[model samples]
Target: MLTETRRVARIVLLDPDDRVLLLNGFEPRNPATTWWFTPGGGLEGEESREEAALRELAEETGITDVALGPVLWTRVCSFPFDGRRWDQDEWYFLARTTQTATDQRGLTELERRSVAGLRWWTSAELSATRETVYPTRLAELVRTLLDEGPPHVPLVLAPEIV
Candidate 1:
C-alpha cells in the first residue's frame, strides 16, 4: 500500500489543575479499536508548526484562548488508519489553559465522525489506564514536564507503529 506523509503539530493541553486533556477516538474503519490522543493534525498550506498547533487545538478541542508553548517532544510514526498507511512527523507542544470545557463545533466532517469525546486526565488516570494512548509513555513524560519543566532541547521519542 502507498503511504501518505505529513508533518503534524500536536498539543499537550493542561488545565489549571494540571490535568492533561486528551481526545478519545477510534479508527475510521474500525470503530471498536479506540485510543486517546492529543489535539492536532497535519499542517495545512504553509502554516508553521506553532500556527498549526494552535489551529488544530482550537478545531479539535475547542480551546483557543490558550497560548502555544515550547515543543516538549517530537516523534515519527507510521501507522494505518482508514485503510491508508501514514508516515507522520509529529511535534508535541506544551500548552496550558484556564479553559477546561470542550466543544466540537469546529471539527471537520471526518473529525466530527471519528472523535468520540474529550476529557481531562490526571497523571494517575493516564498512568493506570489500560487503553491505548498515542505517542507512548505519555504518563512518564508528562510527570517529567510537570516536575522538572520542559527540557532545553526537545526530546525526540523513539518511533512507534500501531
Candidate 2:
C-alpha cells in the first residue's frame, strides 16, 4: 500500500527594514478564527519546492521576481481539518523583495472577506499587537533574521500527533 504525500513550500519575505510578510489565513470549509502566517502554499503536481514558493508568492500577493534562497526552516506537523487529520511537511525558504505589492487580486471573495486587516509591521510592532499569535517567538525570529541574516534552522520533529 502507498501513503499520500503532502508538501507545503512557503517563503518568509523580509523587506529592507526587516518586516516579514505574513498573511491571515482561514479554512473556509470549516470556519475558524483567522490566523496569521507567512505567505505561501502547498506544491501541486510536479512543481519543485522553489517553483512552488515563487508561484505562490506571485499568486497570493501579486509580487514577482523574488530572489529565493536556501531553506531557513522546516517543520513537520499534523492538523485536524475537514473532519480528518492532515499530515503536513512545511518548508520555509529565505526570500527577499524590494518592491511593495500593489494588487491583491489573488485572494478569493471569502478569503478577502475573512481577512480582518493587513499591516506591515516591525518586530516591536509584532510584539505589541495583541492580534498576533505566538507573539514572543515570532518577534524573536523576526529580530534574529533582521539582525544576523537568515539562519538555516531545522526544527526537530518528535513522532507524535501535534
**For this target, which candidate reaches the highest lDDT against the unseen true structure?**
1
TM-score of candidate 1 on Cα atoms, chains taken together: 0.96
Cα lDDT, all candidates = 0.91, 0.69
* Candidate 2: count of backbone clashes, pairs at least 3 residues apart or interchain: 0
- Over 4 Å off, model 2: 1-5, 29-32, 82-84, 108-117, 132-136, 152-162
Candidate 1 lDDT by residue in tens digits, 16-42: 999999999898888998999999999
| Model 1 steric clash total | 0
- Lowest summed lDDT window (length 10), candidate 2: 153-162
Per-residue error at 127 for model 2, in Å?
2.2
* lDDT (C-alpha) at residue 12 in model 2: 79
- Summed backbone clashes in each candidate are 0, 0
Stretches off by above 4 angstroms in model 1 are 1-4
lDDT of 2 by residue, 1-162 (tens): 443557988887877777777776555564465567777777989999999898888777887867887787777656654456767677878888786653578765655755544446678877776764422256666777678876756443342343
